[model samples]
Target: MRPDLRAHALHWHDKTRATQMEFGLWQVWEAGWVTAILRGASITILVGLVSMAAGLVIGIVCGLIKWARIFPLSLLVDAYTSLVRGVPELLIIYLLFFSSVEFVTKVVTAFGYAGVAESGYAFVIAVIAIGAISGAYSTEVVRGALGAIPNGHIEAARALGLSGGRIFRRIIAPQMLRIAVPGINNVWQTTIKDTALVSVVGLQELMRISFIGANSTRHPFIFYLIAAVVYLAITLVSQAGFDAIERLLRVRTRK
Candidate 1:
């Protein structure tokens, strides 16, 4: 077809689809379904943020151990990063669910309480599981960032009689962070997507809620499509924020 005719055909197709949606997409919004999905989305965001924060802490500690080549400790960090990175994230969640649940239950019982419900502890487990996976990747990112800093700079700082803490605080930390931001951002993106996996263990994050909505309403495509759009929105907004941070870092570096 000619260009204008093709455009007209495409527009007509979209209009038809919009008009003929069998269930009327508006129905999904009428009975608080949209509110439920949005609430689930908020949980998804919370899980992602908290998981990433925990991952950053774990990554920094493990990365530093490996970077400093801290003997057997570095070896242990290596094993941790390697194991977590190599495993499927869902398997990790399952492992934590089965393993930690009983142990935590027993502990709670010992403390003069009935065993806590699975749902009660699901969020904590999700955070730890997702954080560990993110941290595994983040360890490599941080280690590489630390490695990128020239040895000469550290030596020079030492030669200037700067204390170890001062050298790290003044020169090393900032540059390492700048170098690591892109890698960390990559991990952050992965972490958010991985939150979807936690749905298997029933954490009620966005994916699980979407699945529930889809099943309950018999509108799988609509709910899943909405989920995709929400995920994309989150990713785009996060990308923009990271981009701004990166540009700001570059400007400071130039100064």
Candidate 2:
């Protein structure tokens, strides 16, 4: 039978006893579920923020390589971005989760270290996997943004005897950011949603916690609803934050 139906069945039983039990369950849920959701939210936000930051750093480096017209290196970056974009995100997560420890152990052994890989290594692997996915998308976003900058500005900077680094820092970076804000916002949303996939690897983010709660309480509908609500709340708040950031940037640019 469906778990929701079963819950309804139990709730519909002898009035007084059912009422008492339901009230107690409600109280427990109010207290414990709130705590669980808060903890899960913290984990999810941390993972999203950290992964996005890591991805941005990696992506900028790769994007610069791709943009620099160093034929072989650009080709390699293109291949990497294409492979990541073409493959399933879940497959990436699984591969990283299962292979990370062995890879770390091998590297450590090669360096003459003796201890086994630590359990916390899974968290690092999760971050890498998610960050890699985000980086792939970010690379394209940054590359496109860089391309959108007018060629005349770069030539003018060059004419002014500005070095490459100074040209990029002073002339290219701000314009690229202005053009890339919307794309980066989309990447951030994608990263937030993608964090849910880490649940399959036993990371106790929001979805994983919801799965546990549903299984333990046998109230799948309730728990799933709660999870959906929590995710929606996160998305809404993040969207607002991004909007505020965009507005602030626009004001500063105007000034």
Candidate 3:
């Protein structure tokens, strides 16, 4: 911790119950646990945001490929979406955590990075694992959003002799995004919650830290409740932001 940030944290901790209670509501939980939680919360946020970005990319590319109906690839995509959505999400996380280590180990060794394959690669794999499941659902949302666009609009673009790429760029893409915002927010919310599952892989995310604290303090309810409240706060703020964006889109549509 930097001098300034450490000082600020101490000042904040002093203002709270850290000094007032020898043992907090959770009798065995350590002092200054709030700082630990803040650290974990930041990791959770980073993982969530990065995984959401990966989901969006996967969704957009796969959704467009599915829309194009390209034979074997389309069928494969259908199977992937179905499999991912059908399985329990925790199973998916477990599978990825177990399976990815060896593959990542090989890659890390090839790149001459030692000891990274265990810890750092686990984080990368967690993002990919969470994003993969989120992407499956996102694919359907994006496809549905694109389907909402009228066929006549594309036909008219063709009638005017616009190229296929140009048609998408000038016509389909913008409307797809505006219509897909709600679905995007839904995926975002789901991804954030799903990040908690990554804790099982030893990700040191908010949920993982809370679970450790709970075990050590024997205050499962208190620790879990803190984690729950943090998740709620994050989701609430995300909802507000998405809703504001939706309103802006609506206003633009009206104009």
Candidate 4:
């Protein structure tokens, strides 16, 4: 090719590349997507935190029942854990959402507030479904942690005349917590990502918002990339916090 023709081709290539890069970046900020994404992220975090907390409570109770081998209740807990863990999470969400919405709608309607049921039900269902799933995993975590406690410590406490509650408070509880932290953190990470599934029910979490933005802007790649980054940020921050807590617990155990 002639020198001038080559220069013209090179210029067009550069211009086209710049335009493509600009379009990609532009799509990310169009339509106040950043703000929308932030809002959705907040909801995701909120749902995750509340669900994890609920799951922890459920897990502790069921785990204790299982650990104590408490007859029929333990059997029920086993069934629950098995049922939840055995099923696909999305299937559980679908079953729970579709099955309970009618009852919830009736209950809400009886109180004279009718407008918010469908919208409100989505969040409730998200929490219930995710919490139930998280709890199943957490139950095993707690059960494992409980089993890890050396029987010798409990026996020593008993020999020292400590009551069951007292021994649990001073010896069993702390050790169990220390043993359980890493497992709980793992559950939390899974739980937060699981929030994405709730988007299917119209919960408007980060994933859902990203999907909407991608569709609206016709730039699925950029929007999804942003969603990935946001999820990564949340995970990194949560991991750091859990690591700190683990370190603190280790220091306390030493002292």
Per-residue lDDT of model 4, residues 145-214, tens digit only: 9999999999999999999999999999999999999999999999999999998888888999999998
Error of 4 at 218 (Å): 0.2
lDDT of 3 by residue, 1-255 (tens): 999999999899887655444454645344666777788899899998988889889999889889888888899999999999999999988888787667767777888788543448768877888889889989998999999999999999999999999999988997898999999999999999989988887788899989888787666777788899999999999999999999998887788
Give the Å error, residue 45, model 4: 0.1
Structure candidate 4, residue pairs in collision = none
**lDDT of all the models against the reference?**
0.91, 0.83, 0.86, 0.92
Cα distance off (Å), candidate 1, residue 155: 1.2
Task: Please state the error at residue 176 of candidate 1 in Å.
Answer: 0.2
Number of the predicted model whose lDDT against the real structure is largest? 4
When 1 and 4 are scored with lDDT, the better candidate is 4
Tell how far residue 247 is off in model 4, in angstroms: 0.5
Give the lDDT of residue 150 in candidate 2.
95
- Winner on lDDT between 1 and 2 is 1
Give the C-alpha lDDT of model 4.
0.92
* lDDT tens readout by residue for model 1, 1-255: 899999999999999887656554776777678888898899999999999999999999999999999999999999999899888999999999988787888887787775554435778889999999999999999999999999999999999999999999998999999999999999999999999999987788899989998888777888999999999999999999999999999999999
Q: Is candidate 1 or candidate 3 better by TM-score?
A: 1
Q: Candidate 2's error at 220, in angstroms?
A: 1.3
Lowest lDDT block of 10, candidate 2: 114-123
Looking at model 3, which ten-residue stretch has the lowest summed lDDT? 19-28
Residue 20, candidate 1: alpha-carbon lDDT? 51
